[model samples]
Target chain A: MSAPTLPDLSGHFGRYGGRFVPEALVRALDELDAAYRTAKTDPEFQAQFKDLLLNYAGTPSLLYRAERLSARLGAEILLKREDLNHTGAHKVRNVLGQALLAKRMGKPRVIAETGAGQHGVASATAAALLDLECVVYMGETDTERQALNVARMRMLGATVVPVTNGSRTLKDALNEALRDWVASVDTTHYLLGTAAGPHPFPEIVRDFVGGIGIEARQQCLDQLGRLPDAVAACVGGGSNAIGIFHAFVPDESVQLYGFEAGGDGVATGRHAASITGGSSGVLHGARTYVLQDEDGQTVESHSISAGLDYPGVGPEHAWLHDTGRAEYEPVTDAEAMAAFQLLCRTEGIIPAIESAHALAGAARIVPALREELGRTPTIVVNLSGRGDKDVHTAGAYFGILDPVETLVPGENS
Target chain B: MSIAEIFAKARAEERALLIGCMPAGFPTVDDSIESMIAMHEAGCDVIEVELPYSDPVMDGPVIQKASDIALGRGVRTRDTLRIIEAVAGAGATVVLMTYWNPIEKYGVNAFARDLAAAGATGMITPDLIPDEAAEWIAASDEHRIDRTFLVSPSSTDERIAMTVAQCRGFVYATALMGVTGARTSVSSQAPDLVERVRHANPDMPVGVGLGVGNGAQAAEVAGFADGVIVGSALIRCVLDAPDRATGLSRLRALSAELAEGVRNPAK
Candidate 1:
């Protein structure tokens, strides 16, 4: 309808985003830009994607309300079941679209970067299903921390290259992936995982992911007859938030809160709250706020959660912050860990560390929200993924020991 | 001879010099640092310090990844100044190839003050237009941070003359329609773009940028301009390393290769 209430060609979300990638990827991204336009209008491609999401990947994931957890937090908490997606995260939504588009373009291989290994796994999963070659760049340290994911990716037929440059994290992995794309501009499609990166990508990612918010928005309206007081999601590169936020930007009544991971704590110099801590500047091909230092060299960032450990945020998130359409808040690792454990013990649902930041933020806001309204307000947390993968780390954090070591398995006391 | 004197000699002896762009932060901030240092040791005519930004719209992914790591390292404008200081401290004449935001953040007077303090000789803000550049030009002129600007083949005659008039150091001539990276073949008619700038200002040095990634590219570009700006290629040599030492070793060899290419253009 009115330009689809979507991003312009420059990748603007209202007044943000534009193509800022290298000139090499221009042809490919343009190919993508043109292809996606036709695909959006093409009944065949749309039908194919719909069927894949439905029969192959399982669409319309559940929205579960946690009564006990909500009672503990003194607020109504609803979980948007993105965890139940085919690959176990909302990132699949973006990769599926990008990979399918690559196949359409007759590209042979898909190259992507991973931080928490979720995006890599998701990309690998999609590539495997589509029978395309996949290459994933993961920071060396991330490979160690996410061994299971590393193995999973290898098993799924994706080559995991451990990036050993600079802090050896997701940002470096991105650097490695970009280098590969620059070298292989002729053949490969760099399947950017989030609503970040240069031009076209931010907008493209938003449109594909806007599926989440669109579905959630309509689903929420039908269920409650009105919009919730606030919509919250953890912001790493802000794919999910933008996905959900884009649909609700017109609805000013629905407050949007983005929770950035404050690893350890904000004051500890080991957090990933780029907006809260970073200044507005040029980075990753767009002018946006990033975590930078005095000399303008991007500072190395740290966060307990692998997904939210990125230094630079999505460009649209920067615009949302500047325009005051959405506000960003930082949640600490301890707080997130507490929420992870709380969700597990109280509701028997272990939330992803990335999603735990949102729950923790919700807990902090619940009291104030309750005090202001004098009644509980409906809060939708995009439980981005399940914490099944984070069990080892969570166990160590909660002082949970090896029970087998403590007691003999064969002898009865 | 000093790097400045060597560049000056190249201008006198070779008819022009080929100043390379190995931005202070690429591959890794440390590798970026090592690349610049190794280039200095290998004798880059003049080094361009690119103040890395998150949104490097004009850069290719090679430079983008390099800048990304520096940005990831929390490397900022101050870090670049220190790098300028490091090179200047080594008595190498340094030029900056950067965007405008860091200048805004650092403030005009202070930015000039710091650049002068760091011993920077010139600058080329790729994103700035001549008309809007007067403010920084004034400040840079005051501190002697020569306000060098960029000119593409598509630039009009009037724009060329105006850019030549406004330019302080050398005019940065872009070789291609795109960013700083290594490419297989630069446009065939690249000399026409160089000739356009050389037509207006024969006195000033014109260094060609964009898509010059190898020694051959550097040597090839020299035939077109006063000097060649070889950046992403030198950095690309060390892009694959497990540690700083390996990166430095690779960078040293690449810088030598680049310097050798600069010495002999035709072969």
Candidate 2:
């Protein structure tokens, strides 16, 4: 079979992705599209990107065999450890590439919208490294939830602006960031966090983050001597999943699963399962599956993981689901939390609640797979980030810290 | 009457047209309609009724806050149409300003039919452009509804020409490279952009928006452009008012001041 290619010249992934932004952003997007085209072919740009990945962000993250998880689930489970990367998530990979591209485009300032604050921290890290002025727009609620990451971004010299608009979450932050970009397009590059947004952004982010899939594909072959039966990743805006899913798209024998955050459950109408439970509509400059009411007004999505608390997914993910190239399912908050705690106890690896959704999804499918296959199947779950930032939330949810104890962490202990 | 007729009438009077914008159901549905009617009676030549969206990415903080209030109060597409119907019934040229998603969900043809039937003469889609607006273009043409497309300062000559060709009424010239808001100074790029749009299509009346606040700023924009569009400032007037009656009165006062400024450009 030939190689898998997507998002045609106009940035349509089978009618899913298009530039649905305002006229003010058209020229900037066009310029970005042209610059990315040039940068993609330029060997110097590629060399610089590779060097950063190797020495700075630390690419080729390990694919470890989760033996305990496999033994318990009756399937061979492998953990693609993206949590080990700089900034403790897969976000750094894309931020660095975009930061370098910004430099090449003669942009001196970088801005991004972050939800869980991982992308904000990662973008701030990239900006500090590149010496570009950085600003991050985060939802006010997110700043309160993910305080550590907010502090980390500020420490890295980024101005963290809290957005208190609609929903006060990722979607709202995205809106504010786009507003900033419209005003500052002359000197500021919007370091979009996910494989979403208008033309060139989805494609550009996917290419940069596709390193996860590229490295994982080779590492799986080297470690297991064969490809996994299925690869699962959590999907919010779907950057991390798309990152690892792109390289495997051409490999027809492999199955791809995207786990969306089911805040309560799809039936409860309080979930972020855009692909699973959403209808196709436009949001954040792309025509994708969005959680909207019958009138096309975007509905608020709830999730324990701030990163996955979005009403929309990447357009490519929508195309992938429509074309039957990939399957998307929801992992409820309870199920994801269980998997989060289980991974901590069994594998000694605490994952971001976002990544735990993938774990929960794999757990849900494994029992059925064992019954159907009559043999152990190999599964690789993308552990997209470490859980240090989520420890406070987890402690609260589990009631591990009392009210007085929570007041002072190290001091009380 | 068509948007061209409005501009032509303004030109005949030797004054740039003053276009007032306010979101539907802002503060409240009926109150918003009453406020817009008051502005129209005071001096607004054309009233642009904004269909408040869930995510208004193109709007500044003031408009965003107004839209949030509207949406929070349960304003929908049908309510916006109702507001437009009331405003148009009061003998003012009405145009609907909306983001694309709601229309896409509401069905382009259905929205066009409803908008036209409600007495709205035109539409200003902030997010939808000529390149990706084939559905809207066809629907608007079928309904004989004027379609106004935005042209930014950063637009290339080719882009300007393309947008001008698709525009049925005046081309919306975004005064600055930013989201919609009132500003102290008209962007230096506004005149150049208006010139570029004129060069592309001299017949197309150019309306400059996105930063015209008070009368002086309106006069500055009106000096070069055929129409002066005001939105955030009008919303702010109502937002800062002590009561609904005062808000409507303030909206009328601001509209009258801007209307006078458009007629008499500052030298």
Candidate 3:
């Protein structure tokens, strides 16, 4: 079969992605699509984007060989250190790209929807750097869970609005953002934070973050003289996973794996494993794998990692799963936390719980890879973010520190 | 009567039609059916039954609250069909309004077939546009049901024309560039957008929605448009009432006032 070419003009990834938004936003989507198309080929746009990635956001993040963890897991694991970026996550790359695009398009303001607040922080950072007005819509529950990130966003001169509707989580935040975008699309850009949502967004985000895969692909060729056996990344809306998987998609020898969040477990009916446990439907703006009831109402997704607690996965990941070019599995909260503690102890690396899902998934598949290869299997894992924001949650989970009571700052004081 | 026939009848009388909206199964399925019948008897020309969805992006807080109450009461997609059947049986011209996902989940063709069988004249899809509505368009045609796609103030001339061509019962004109809610004043953009839609297809009836509340606002919207669509304001009657009797009484009073407003168009 021919290599996969996706998101045809209509933004569909094999029936997985399309615009399911209101008519009020259509003109803005069209304008954005046109602007992105022009910017994609323009050398000036590329130069500006590249300059920021290299000098500001600090791209070409290190691809370190995790020998200690590899020894313990019986696999040669290479970690793509996206956590070391300026914003402590791979999300900064897409933020910077979109912020620059907003500037070029003459949109002075940007609005974003965030779940864990990492994307919100990254968006605020880029907005401050680009001198654009930024407003973030964060779920009320998330604002309490990730309070530090909220403060960080405020410090960057971004106004963070707490969304209180429907499940009070990521999906609600997304809905509120769309509502804002409808009224403000003329002067503001919806700087979507993932490789999901309508057409152009999935493609745009993948293109902006695809550098993770490009850099790692060359690093592997230089260090090991060949491609690794597998590439692993955590999939929420699947931005980081798609970021790392896009370049390796055509490399028939490299296996792509996306690890989704299994909150309690898939069997418990409370997990965020959209691709693994959900069915096909539309959410946010795209048709993808969604956790929904028989009546087509969206079901709330649960995950210890707030970033992965979304009911929908990116459309491309859904397409990839259907095409059998990639494999997805659920990493339960217990298993992810175990891998998280293990990484900190064995490798002295504190990974975001979202990224720990990748490490745990790699560990789960190592034995199978060993049996198949009859030798040490080389794997590249995308450490999508750092654990600085998750320290409190992790500490409480391990009983090292008492869980802090959530404070809304000005309320009930 | 069909939506087109109702529009024609209202036009012959030289007045716009008043369309009142409520979520199916708000509080409960049977209560919602009673609410629609009451609104119709009080003088709403058309009843727009919104299927309560979990994520209603286009709805403002008031409608969202009502929909949440409906979903919390276990209102399913099939329940919406039953509500539609009951409301239509009350001699009201009924239309179903929804986001695309529920219909997609119910199977587009199956939903179209069921909705037609249930006596809904057409569907008003706030989210689904003609650009991405091939499956729905085909299904709606095969089932002989009308499809109402919205045109917004932000819609370009080409897009408005394209969206108008795909519409059947009537073309919906979003008066403002915002979600569904009641505003203190009707949008300044509504008249211009209606004119644009008229330019696209003058013969196709245009129903203006979003931010319309109270008889005066309805009259102002009715002056220029063929239909004045009200959602959040009507749902608020039941939502804020102290009891069910109070809710129906308030609903009937408001519906009568709005009906009076539409009959006495400001134009």
Candidate 4:
């Protein structure tokens, strides 16, 4: 077979991907580009990483088949239990890899942009482990919604700066993070939450995330004697998808599907469906595809799930779609919410809204499997995190919880 | 080779796409299109028409204010596409330079088709990162719209080589470490930066932009680079002028001045 097309460093996946950063941050990027190459080869770093994942962060996270859900949906359901990860979610997996890379690069502090607070928590977790100063940029709005996460980051000794500018959301927080990074290019490393950003971030984060595929591929083979037919995951800056998609890319048999947040509906003016819907442009320092105006301003996105509400996606996804390696689709807010409730009832598993995108997509995929193949096929849905944190929003939507005015007895966290 | 031929002749000379900072719908869609026409008329390689966003942290005050005015005046994609059509009517090569959100809202493939139909040769969204380029780039390429990518000085030798290979038009070489602005001193390390680029790509023309102000700086940058890009300086000129003719004339004059500087950098 011909060699897989190597992704270029400008981060292009066949005309997508680029460094769209501020001028001040160029040196830092260059420094990172240089340090990452050296650090990747260091056995010491690898040994330390291996030790952390195995000991502190629980290596080889279990891939449990969702037998009941599979039977119910008429297709095999597998769970890549990233929830078993330390501090929950697959965000820590990336943070650990980057924080270690940062330590090797001799950076003083680690910076991050957070939405639902999972990334902030994970970054704080990594910083605490590595003894690095952590500064996580969170939007004021997000801080209000994910108050516990805000407090959690602070409790972990991280400085949480709420971004009050520009719609006061995740994207705005990202702008502030990039600004801080630009101002202090030398001493800080942006521990990006997802596989979005510029060249090295997409490539490096994907490398770190390949562990998921490695573990899952082996587990599937050991259990079922062959790789699963398809693997699906939620796309928020698309880290989980990258984590699951990397090892499977070379395996032509195992299909990869990434589900984006479609918000109220694709018909409505709300959603974060960048790959399935967005146009080509730049944001946060990479020229991939993003939701923007004809003038290049980032457009605001809406989703019931805050984590998957981001308007841009990773560049490699652009490459994948261009090359036809992976297929991306949007999962609407109602459908995701229904899936969220469905998972809670079916498997006693409450999933984060971002991960709910995968469940919602999987819900659709299950019915199609029976008609298409005439056999129930095994599939893995990366349960990225437990939905313990997003209970407030979930409760509000179903009217299970009260509005902000009068608090219930146990509502005061 | 001819200037237009150079841009078209991707194999020979490095194709450079020119992006101008003008408030969309400003001076009127007609005026904006005329400026695009003027850039093309004055031998600009490829036109990057910015859709002025209000909170453009990436841009300096000039482009930032232009973004505000354009966006504040409600210059939507429809208006910008009208401008693209007008520019194409003027027989100019054009592309859309914007952030990603609006395009995402518009739908990727539809946007690509609309842009290509409006006669846009390509797009330059500085913020659509590499990992997310799959849908937009793929759909656009299928529709025959080239996507331009940015390459910074901080980009490694390997990455620069990668960008030089992947990017369809010329590489946008940022001149300094800040947003686009007028600087008194041309980045002192510009010649060396140009030399470094030359070592990596002895072929492609690097468009030296950001921080370049006067003809002297332009000329100095031209000494080591292929083209001198003046954004804030020219935009500032248009904003300062009272009327359209004066602004257009000033734009032409600056273009000529910068071109002259490129020809004789020692001066």
Judged by DockQ cut-offs, the docking class of candidate 3 is: high
Report chain B TM per candidate. 0.91, 0.98, 0.99, 0.84
Candidate 3 has a TM-score of: 0.98
Best by TM-score: 3
What is the C-alpha local distance difference test score of each model? 0.77, 0.92, 0.94, 0.76
Pull out the clashing pairs in model 2: none
Clash counts for all predictions: 36, 0, 0, 46
> Across residues B92-186, which tens digit of lDDT does each residue of candidate 2 receive?
99999999999999999999999999999999988998878989999999998999999998889999999999998888999889988888888
**Top-lDDT candidate index:** 3
TM-score of 2: 0.97
Q: Rank the candidates by lDDT, best first.
A: 3, 2, 1, 4
Score candidate 1 by DockQ.
Answer: 0.17
Runs off by more than 4 Å, candidate 2 = A1-3, A403-413
TM-scores of all candidate predictions against the true structure? 0.78, 0.97, 0.98, 0.70
What does the lDDT read for residue A293 in candidate 2? 91
State the lDDT of candidate 4 residue by residue for B26-130, as single tens digits: 656677777767766765555568766544556765776666566666777788888988887777666677766567657789989998888878776665544
Per-residue lDDT, model 2, residue B132, is 83
Range of the 10 consecutive residues with the lowest summed lDDT in candidate 1 chain A: A15-24
- Residue A203 Cα positional deviation in candidate 1, in Å, after optimal superposition: 1.5
Q: What lDDT score is found at residue A155 in candidate 4? A: 93
TM-score of decoy 1? 0.78
